[model samples]
Target: MSDTLIEAGKRTIELEAQAVKALGERIDGEFAKACEMILNCQHRVIVTGMGKSGHIGGKIAATLASTGTPAFFVHPGEASHGDLGMITQDDVVIAISNSGSSAEVITLLPLLKRMGNPLISMTGQNQSPLAKAAHAHLDISIEQEACPLNLAPTCSTTATLAMGDALAVALLEARGFTAKDFAFSHPGGALGRKLLLKVEDIMHSGNELPRVEKTALISEALMEMTAKGFGMTTVMDGQELLGVFTDGDLRRSLDQGIDFNTATMIDVMTAKPLTISQNRLAAEALGLMDAKKITALVVEDDQQQPVGLLHMHDLLKAGLV
Candidate 1:
């Protein structure tokens, strides 16, 4: 039974793989025209379909929106009931139906035609009514279904989804859509945090900053670092930054027989220490710390004044490392 199940799984995957490969080879002038129509659309692309194709359409729409092309899915069943209003004159419609004759999707054709919306169709049969009516038709036709019965929507739906992804990626390249642009669309996701979370957003600022006077005793800087739990402290003269004192510096000072009770920050601090701009991404600060083999950084402003402190713990807590 185990062997039988494994063989079935492999056969199903093999059939689907061949179906997708065939779909890839079928890309031609029609695909180019479909891409051009979508690129020229002044507004969003409205994707619609029934059943399994509808599920695929929703994902395709989401992928397009995230990748820079604005798009959304509409249920063909709801279009006749008032959802047709969601499509605007400048919008493009992508209708998906493996058989190319989904009744509910076909019913929206006359309405979309009246609204002057361009139509792109994904169908298994090129000669079907929906395909014939489309401004550009994508042939998602497959040799056979992955289902043993050859009666299910498996291979055809997979082909349609692959074609949708191809179209979205092509449009993404054409638009020169950038990583920064994608970050804005997914600010709450991990990629957004990596690309958008800045030093100021995660740094300990204001009263939480570890600071001591340039003339302060080494013991006093140690106390400040301990109180702030940042493993380091800034040595400042009014609004000007003189240098930074860290646990490493303390170790080196003690090795040199320096007295913490009398040695001031001027004698024990590391001057001209590495600092980061508060406006820069925390990822940059993380990189700097990793490259320097250090654990903390002083967050500075445009005036080069220390405004905050960032530690490796901050990056760990922010899920950037």
Candidate 2:
């Protein structure tokens, strides 16, 4: 029975994969026209559908909105009950229906035409009323459903969703939407922290900086490291960053039989330590730390003066790691 279930799952996946592949072949002038219509839309793209198609339409609208094309989902059932008022002549409408003849959605066609709003239809039937009426018709037809009985909307819905993604990505490319722009749309997400949070925003500054004068004894650098809890300290000359002394340097000092009391930072510090600009992204700082196998780095200003100190722990606390 377990083997039978595994086979069934694999068959379902194979069928759906084939359906998506068929949809890929259908990406042509109609798909380009749909993308262009959404791109040139002066107002929001209004998406509507019925039943399972409605659920897919909602997700497609979200994808479009998040990827730089402004869009919102409007249920066809609700539109017949006055939600149609949300759409305007300036807006473009994308209607989704497997059969392409859902009554609730078709009811809005006359009103949409009167308002001179462009309609893009995603449907399984090429000759359906909705497809015939659309300014652009995306063929999301599938040979069969992934269901054993070939009765469910499985493969058809998958094709519709993939076609929706194709439209969104095409529009995304046309608009030159970037990762930074995507981060702005998802400020509360993990990607936003990785892309938007900067070293200056999370770096230790002012009194939080772990440092010692270049002329300070190794014992003083150790004290600063302990006080700052970074296991390291910058050896500075005034505001100018001269070098860094880390726990690794301390271990080497102990190994070399150097007297901690007499040894100065100049004797123990790693000179010309790597530094990052304060304006750099925290994710980039994390990358630098990982590449160098170091835990901390100095943040410098345009004048090449140390303004802050960034540690690996800062990236962890900010959720950029």
Best by TM-score: 1
TM-scores of the candidates in the order shown: 0.95, 0.89
Tens-digit per-residue lDDT, 257-294, candidate 1 = 99777889999999989999999999999999999999
Q: Residue-wise lDDT of candidate 2 within 84-167, one digit each (tens)?
A: 889999999999999999999999999999999999999999999999999999999999999989888899999999999999
Candidate 1 residue spans exceeding 4 A from truth: none
Candidate 1 differs from the real structure by a C-alpha RMSD in angstroms, to one decimal, of: 1.5
> What TM-score quantifies how close candidate 2 is to the native fold?
0.89
lDDT of 1: 0.92
Q: Which stretches of candidate 2 lie over 4 Å from their true place?
A: 2-7, 187-192
**What range of 10 consecutive residues in model 2 has the weakest lDDT sum?**
218-227
